[model samples]
Target: MDKIRIKNLELFAKHGVFPEENALGQKFLVSADLYTDIRPAGLTDDLNASIDYGMVCHKIKDFLEQHTFRLLETAAEKLAWSLLTEIAGLKKVTLEIQKPWAPVGLPLETVSVRITRGWHTVYIALGSNLGEKETYLRNAVESLNQADGCRVEEVSEFLVTEPYGYTEQDDFLNGCLCLRTLLTPEELLALLHKLEQEAERKREIRWGPRTLDLDIIFYDDLVMDSRDLQIPHGDMQNRDFVLRPLAQIAPYVRHPILKKTVGGMLADLEHSQKI
Candidate 1:
């Protein structure tokens, strides 16, 4: 929410496509905007409460000098990720890497790459109906926690519930997980699919029994409609299995489109069922 700007910090580094350019080294200018909550630091006048700009600049300089990349895009991406991963109390970062002296014959001002990187809050619903369901769920959580750029913050207690889509299959062990990650929604989806495949998940029938089922229930309050995925999972509000566990971890997590908390949604479902 708050901004700490570091503008046009110059660095001399050996980063270029040409062999001669790499050998000789070049001058590059970097600009970054660090986003975080600085209220505590400002109010208490505590240095420890906030990130030190000097340290950030030094870290960036060192990173540039230590690594050699042929493309500015690669450098910018790595720098942005490094800052987000290394910096404390950082919510998001916008980094720009500028290379002024280009080999292009035209007299251009500068060539640069700019990108925004941040941590996203995602809610995942995990379930399994076959082959040690509890172990499958726990292992899935463990795998996600061990993943790079992803952190499992909270997990709801697993609940044993009857199958939802088809009554023929075994009852599923279901739960919810709260995660903070640097991966985009698409990337996260891919990782989930990979984990499922590793568990030998079969897709012969829609909502069929599986070794493990991990679904993206919500992603940072994002409301998305795509052929492959949908955010605020289309049927989550109506599914007691999903809301029951999700409410345990995030009772107050509001649905972006419905503007109702998970607890409220669960209550509404209960009320409707009774009537």
Candidate 2:
């Protein structure tokens, strides 16, 4: 990643814990490090191939002036999102918002809040066996793409397969997705649950057919296990339905625990059937 640094740009904005500070406003300094690959622009000698720093500075100033927040933390977080979303070719942003005139009675140089935000790659498994399964899957993809910090990068073709568990149910339409998101693992999980509920998904019967089933199979090679969520889902390797579609999109994606690529795992799973 290449660095584009903008240091200590001055701005007058209304953001503070004190009402007087918000009303009267104060001088604030903003700095940012916009991370992106500069090779294309450098080689091509084209301004169009790179993100425009001047435009980004204007955007940051405008955003800060337009909104009032109680804390610099809140302002920095929001601005970081705004820049990361609005700027093309920008992969990440490290933002700092500095307040020079602290209301503190003690002698202090300055106070600031800094934050870093960017997109992360994630793989999600999609399944629905009951009621317009295809529609549910499509809706799930669209819903995620509409989210603030999420984008649907690639989607595997839906594959019809026999029910895995609670086998008495109808066949399922299963597939996987490659997604880019800014949300942390837990935040992404919460969003998936919200989408599930919107699709009228119910969990009354274990492994039973449902309106929609969205599982976070992998999140940026992250491995986690807890009461409510698990990354590199516990049963993904054992289920052909999960691996088949996952391999379609990310054949070379290595499982954090298994040390096997998705394609390799699927091949091994298929080979075992002959034994």
Candidate 3:
């Protein structure tokens, strides 16, 4: 990745905790490092092939001047998200917002908040065994596409497969879809739960029948083991249902933890079943 740097871009904005601060406004300095591949623009001498730092500077000034927030943290966070959402070719951004006129009694030069944000590639598995299964799968994909900060990149063909855990129910319509999202894993999981509830999913029985099941199979090679979520989906390597569909879309996407590609895992799982 290459870098485009913008430094010490000063602007007057009303962003502070004090009431008078908001009314009078204050001077702030913002700097950003944008990460992207500039090869196309460099080789072709075309500005359209890369991001424009001049335009980004203007946007930052406008956004800061238009919005009023109490915390620089809030301002920086929202600004980072705005840049990531609005900028077409920007891959990652590191932003620093500096406030020089602080009310603190100390003689410090300045106070600033620095943050980084970017889009992540995620693979999600969709499954439903009850009532109009394929519709549920398609609806899930549509819902993900409609959600803010999420773009559905590709979807695998649906497969009819038997249940995984408690296998007494009818077969399920299973598939996987690739997503580009700005949300963190936890935020993504929350949104999925909301979608499931919209589908009238029941949680009374563990691994029991459900109207919709959405699982995050992979999140940008992230490895996590928090109470609420697990990356690489816990059992994706062992489940033919998940790997079969995921392999179709991202056969070469490697599991960060296991050091195996999706296709390789599917092959191993199938071979083990034969034995």
Candidate 4:
């Protein structure tokens, strides 16, 4: 990842805990490292190929001036989100906000907050076996696209598949989608649960009938396991409903643990079933 650095750009903004600070405002120093691919810009000498630091500076200044926060942490968080969303071609950002004025009786050089934020590519599997299954799956896609900090990039055609663990139920309408999001794994899982609840999903039986079922299949090649959530879903490789649709959209995406592409895994599964 290449970076365009903007350092020590000063601005006056109303952002502090004290009421007097908001009323009178204060000097704040802002800095950012805009991360993106700079090869195209360097090779072609095209400014359009790269993010413009000048415009970004103005954006930062304008954002800080318009928003008021009692904490530097909150201000930095919102500013990082704003820059990542608004600035095209920016993949990651490290933002810093420094307040030089000390309200404390003790002398201090400056108090600052610095943080890094970026978009992460994630794969999600969707399934529904209850009434209006196709409608449920489609609505899930739309809802995710409309959600903040998330964007649906690609979707696979839905497939009608037999129930896996538990039989004697209607087949499932299953599909997968690629999502670009700013949410952490936990946050993403929470959003998925919320969407499932909205669709009236139930967890009465394991892998049984449901109005909607959402699973996190992959998150940027990350491997994590906890009581609450798992990344690179534990059983995705063995499930055709998950692999087939995921392969359609991301065949070359490799599993971090198994080191196999989606297409490769699907082929292996099909072969094993025949044997």
Q: Relative to the unseen true structure, what is the C-alpha lDDT of residue 17 in candidate 4, on a scale of 0 to 100?
A: 93
Tell me each candidate's RMSD, in Å, in order: 1.1, 1.1, 0.9, 1.0
Q: Which residue segments of model 1 deviate by more than 4 Å?
A: none
Arrange candidates, best TM-score first: 3, 4, 1, 2
Q: Return the lDDT, model 2, position 85.
A: 82
lDDT, candidate 1, 1-275, per-residue tens = 99999999999998889997788888999999999999999999998999999999999999999999999999998988888888889999999999999788899999989999999999999999999999999999999999988899999999999898888999999999999999989899999999999999999999889999999999997988888899989999999999999999999999999999999999999999899
Q: What local lDDT score does residue 84 receive in model 2, on the 0 to 100 scale? A: 81
The lowest-lDDT stretch of 10 consecutive residues in candidate 2 is 81-90
**Candidate 2 stretches greater than 4 Å from native:** none
Q: Output the lDDT of residue 151, model 1.
A: 90
- For all candidates, the clash counts are 0, 0, 0, 0
Score candidate 2 by TM-score against the native: 0.97
lDDT of 2 by residue, 1-275 (tens): 89999999999999988999889999999999999999999999999999899999899999999999999989998998888888888899999889988788989888988889998999999999999999999999999999988989999999999998789999999999999998999999999999999999989999998999999999987889999898889988889999999999999999999999999999999999767
lDDT of each: 0.94, 0.93, 0.94, 0.95
Report clash pairs, candidate 1. Answer: none
Alpha-carbon TM-score of each model against the true structure: 0.97, 0.97, 0.98, 0.98
Better of 1 and 4 by TM-score: 4
Clashes of 2: 0
TM-score of 3: 0.98
Pairs of residues clashing in candidate 3: none
